[model samples]
Target: MDASELLEVLSPEGLRLLDSLPPWRASDDVVSSVAALRRQGHPPERVSAVLTQARLRARAEAKFGEFASRMLFTEAGLEQATRLNVAARHADRYRSAGLTSVADLGCGIGGDALAFAALDLDVLAVDRDEVTAAIASYNLSPWPSSRVRQGDAETADLTDVQGVFLDPARRTSGHSATKRIADPADWSPSLEVAFGYAERLPTGVKLGPGVDRDLLPRDAECQWISVDRDVVEAGVWFGPLARAGVGRSALVISASGAAELTAPADSEDVEVGDLGEWIYEPDGAVIRARLIGDLARSIDARTISRDIAWLSSDERVETPFAQGFRVLETLPLDERTLKRELRSRGIGRLEIKKRGVDVDPATFRKRLSLQGSGSATLVLTRVAGRHTALLCERA
Candidate 1:
């Protein structure tokens, strides 16, 4: 949102209107709500601003949960903001290290700063954008220990800060419709500057999960986190904030709970083997953290191919690190043969998964002309240097 929109949203009347509005829903009659508010003597701009906030709050629920209702967000800020649960873990690192003060440089809408403040740490949340900083201030208003300011993160006054959390703006500057910055140097607080903070104090840098691994520091502990099967962020920690004896780690958070796998460094790939009774798909976090080998070994499995992430085992093994599927049979990889085979099996509802294959599951499925009543998973992958299809069931 722009500065004017923000001003309208933050006004007492605007906040009251936002609070009074019913929970936002995709099916809600937005036009009617706008007309009603306009007829109630609310200015068009104020109504629009509050309604935008209501919509943003609805979208923010996935990241912030109930806290989102009371929080403010910009489209870009909400998109880049860390998940509340994940941010709590980041805050815990500082709390565990006995760090009482933290400077959250490039803090977008105070996602991590809220966690820090919630943990009672003295927080200085800074953002270069005035609108984002203002929104962050609003989100963090409940925490007296937290403060928000508009300033360049690269030049933020560290002063007596004990720890630093740097989330460099990875996108072009804007409250909405921003584009990703391809080069790290183009980032608002460049990677170089963000990493520089680690040299001076206990620091944690949050980057995209797909960030270049070669760019990571050898001395820092890099952790990849996935929430509900989606790989979210790669956090690199240095100094006391870095976990002991851990160079790479994957943290999987799901409804079940959080599980972590750590190693001193990337684990060596396991030897390739023939297709076994079961296939295991490692969590995205595990793959991103390059700990797939470790996960495979933990479950007494082996990779199906040299570079593919899929693993196989003779016996069924249950682990949070991976999803296990039982192989029912094998089918020819060719489209016509696969279609014939699937039709024979009466498979209709199909879940397609592939690795090291050129086929797009959606496009391939359409070509199959599926018309059966059964449901099955088709895993198209390379096995011992050959393309193969494994018909599977959830284990």
Candidate 2:
């Protein structure tokens, strides 16, 4: 049986055999097998330790010196709760609000709860999984102020908490286990009810980055945060974030730098103008939060098209929220003879992009052999209902 299949069975004999094997000897066999699987086009991420106690050890190693428990490597995929980028952001919010006590509603493996406790904040870390809860307890063992408990979120008793952090279980299916809000009310009690709860104190609800913007409650101030150009989390502030009017801020964080972009709820819009020498692509969260106007004003740029998301600027603006690219050329729509023109220029590998077009990137790439050694960004989009191309280089 494959290692994962055997591990799934949790056989007594298999466990015994694995246990009897020496570490050095076992490592050789496991590494060789994993290499073969990888060569055969299988994802070797968590497959090797499927039937070994080393599975836990492997997880610990992947966590990079951080302790993690109740981490599940199920059919859906390896999901563990620990101090991730988003969790760290939430920890900052809690500290900023001067919250002394916090309730972590769906504390998976005590990642954020531990962060809260590390700050000397009294925290109740709750998880429904027994194995995960045990792991969380061990992970949070160093923190005396944090308590890890096992209970269903719907029925759990939460009281006297100065702030609440809810990252509800987004999995409802097997294997894929994609992000889904199966029951919106399970964690917050309800949309309106959750807002009411937030009105009382600082509440941070961790929603997937893909959540509909229209669903965001108007009463709660929203901040879309991106770490190192990657949109990590969108935080809602009820008590403090609201009072500060940092309403619609884009938090850009990196190892070398950090920036906070705050604008009014209805910031002035930049008028659409001709394409400039450079193009700036804003981070997803920044675009979704409609902070583009603020970014454009800061960079002295204008929109290429009101409908299109691309921003054009003549001056250089260094911000984590947007990637600036220098324009090589802009050509008119010529799909009928497009392949011939690209072939003549020795272009074979094309990275197709679309903003105001209905073309597929994969399909377009396959149809033409964009030959060239250097990297270039090709925009295959419709401007005025006609296909056009914009060859670009890094700015």
lDDT of candidate 2 over 295-354, digit per residue (tens): 888888888876677888776677677888887778865564666666666676666667
Clashes of 1: 0
User: Model 1: per-residue lDDT, tens digit, 182-201?
Assistant: 89998878898889987789
At residue 326, candidate 1 shows an lDDT of 98
Q: Find the candidate with the highest TM-score and give its number.
A: 1
**Candidate 2: stretches off by over 4 Å:** 1-83, 173-179, 182-193, 241-243, 382-386
Candidate 1: regions farther than 4 A off: none
Give residue 135's lDDT in candidate 2 (0 to 100).
50
Report how far off residue 18 is in candidate 1 (Å): 0.4
Tell me each candidate's TM-score: 0.98, 0.78
Report how far off residue 324 is in candidate 2 (Å).
1.0
